[model samples]
Target: MSEASLLKTQVVTLRVPNELKSRLEQQAKSQGVSLNNLANYLLTTQLSQLETLSGIEQRLRGRNLNDLKQKIAFLLNKVPHNPDLPEWDRL
Candidate 1:
């Protein structure tokens, strides 16, 4: 990336709850990032998720069980499954 690309970044100001501020500060320090950079990255990622979910929820709010089941199946497929081990017979 060139210097112009880095210089094209926008400045944003946001107020976080006091507890979250301390946690973010610690995370930023440990990751060797400035607080602003950490906040910007997190906010950008979460905001994108929020926008997507908001659209989905708006469409599905009053839908029926079939829709709900399909959503559940989609999420379940994304998760790794672990099978239960057989129980040992006690003496």
Candidate 2:
């Protein structure tokens, strides 16, 4: 494991509705990760995505479709086109 993954974590309590909690538990089981892992991943990734979209919205507030397409293509190009997935990441 990486040092970052080894860092200490604190427990947090949330009072989610029963339905939401059940859904999250089901999703975590389907994804082969503990509920804690799934919750942590969802919270961290969703926040980052929300922040990214906020910045993109401000930048492209008055932009046209072509501008949006170009920005999307530029961002997509940054990802490597690798098909191989490590065993831990395979689902």
Candidate 3:
């Protein structure tokens, strides 16, 4: 990533329900962190979790495909080479 692509601090206005805003402020105060910092921390944590989950999903998909192939090969090996019944059409 380039510095130019990085996000620099920018101010934006947001309107939240009064109760929610108060709750956030209270939580921030209790945690001894500014509301902005707390929000940023939460977002960063969630983003990291999402990245981790994505990697896990990719691994699971690869495993599933491999298992399917193995099952198909096993079934093919079990198929009967010769039928026990005589051919009715030839009679």
Candidate 2 lDDT by residue in tens digits, 1-91: 9998879788889999999999999999999999999999999999999999999989978879898799989998887766687877643
Best by TM-score: 2
| C-alpha RMSD for every candidate | 7.4, 9.1, 16.4
- lDDT against the true structure, each candidate: 0.86, 0.92, 0.84
What TM-score do all the candidates reach, one by one? 0.52, 0.56, 0.53
Better model by lDDT, 2 or 3? Answer: 2
Please tell me which predicted candidate would have the highest lDDT against the true structure: 2
**Candidates 1 and 3 compared by TM-score, better number:** 3
Could you give candidate 3's per-residue lDDT for residues 1-91 as a string of tens digits?
8797666777868888999889989999999999999878877999999999999897777477878789989998887666665787332
- Off by more than 4 A, model 1: 1-7, 17-19, 66-91
The CA lDDT at 89 in model 3 is 31
Model 3 vs. true fold: TM = 0.53
Query: Residue 76 of model 2: what lDDT?
Result: 83
- Model 1: per-residue lDDT, tens digit, 10-65? 76677779999999999999999999889889988999999999999899888997
**Runs in model 3 with CA error above 4 Å?**
1-7, 12-16, 65-91
